[model samples]
Target: MKVVNENLPEEKPRHLLGIGEPEDIVEGVRLGCDTFDCVAPTRIGRTGTIYIHRNGKLEKTSLRKPEYQRDFSRLDEGCDCAVCEKYTKAYVCHLVRSGEILGGHLCSIHNLYTIVNFTNKLRDEILHS
Candidate 1:
């Protein structure tokens, strides 16, 4: 990404293909990428994996894990997404363990929101800098 950013004209928008991980997205923006596309968020969400921010770092949590079976906390702490606002880890874990479609949908919503929100913040920071 650094090489690409160095070679490209600064004024031209750079679209990064298949880059969707939270940390990667941050680095991509820092390197001047203007946009990104990938199915990772929804794909992993389908399997009950979610992106979460903790202690200033991005982490992946699998709702299907046994530890979440009794965890009643929000999906991701500090997230304002509807799923995070309305659901608990235990509930989502039950849905995923039961193979309910709503589990995937809720996870996808939270995952997408996480990435989009993070990207927007990065954009704001760059704009203000």
Candidate 2:
């Protein structure tokens, strides 16, 4: 990235493709990347996994695991999206374990929402700093 940045105009935006982890995004931004995109959030959500922001970092959890069987909680306590607003962890866990399509759909919704919210917060912090 240092080498790449050296050859580009400072005022121009640099897009970092196929990178999406919060930590990676921060690193890429510091190294001159001004944009990023990836299918990981949706892909992982399809597999019954989702991201959550925790302790100032991104954390992931699998809904198919037995641990969620009795746990009743929203996908994200801080999220107010349709999925998080109406679904419980136990329900989503059942959907995933039962091979229901709505499981993936709900997961996708939360994953995308999480990323979008995180980015918005990031932008606000950057602007304020």
Candidate 3:
């Protein structure tokens, strides 16, 4: 990314493809990427995994796991997405466990929100700096 940034015109916007992981996105921005696109968030969410922020880092939790069966906490404590605000890990887990499509949809919403929000914050920091 650094090499590409160095070779490209600084005035041109950099659009990174197939890059969506939070850590990767942060690094991409630091290396001069202006935008990114990928299906990771929704793809992983469909498989029952969702993103969560913990200790200032992003992590994934599988709703299909037995551990989430009774976890009443928000989908992500740091997130303000509707799923995190209105749903519990236990309920989402039940939906996943029962093969309900809503579980995937909720997870997708949360994951997409997380990435978009993170990117927006990164953009704000860069612009303000």
Q: Model 2: which ten-residue window has the lowest total lDDT?
A: 50-59
Candidate 3, residues 101-123, lDDT tens digits: the string is 99999999999999999899998
Q: What is the lDDT of candidate 3?
A: 0.93
Q: Each candidate's root-mean-square deviation in Å?
A: 1.3, 1.3, 1.0
lDDT of 1 by residue, 40-79 (tens): 8899999999998889876898999999999999999969
lDDT leader = 3
**Candidate with best TM-score:** 3
The TM-score between candidate 3 and the true structure equals 0.95
Candidate with more favorable, higher TM-score: 1 or 3: 3
Runs off by more than 4 Å, candidate 1: none
Q: Given candidate 1, what's the lDDT at residue 113?
A: 95
In model 3, the clashing pairs are none
Off by over 4 Å in 3: none
Error of 1 at 108 (Å): 0.4
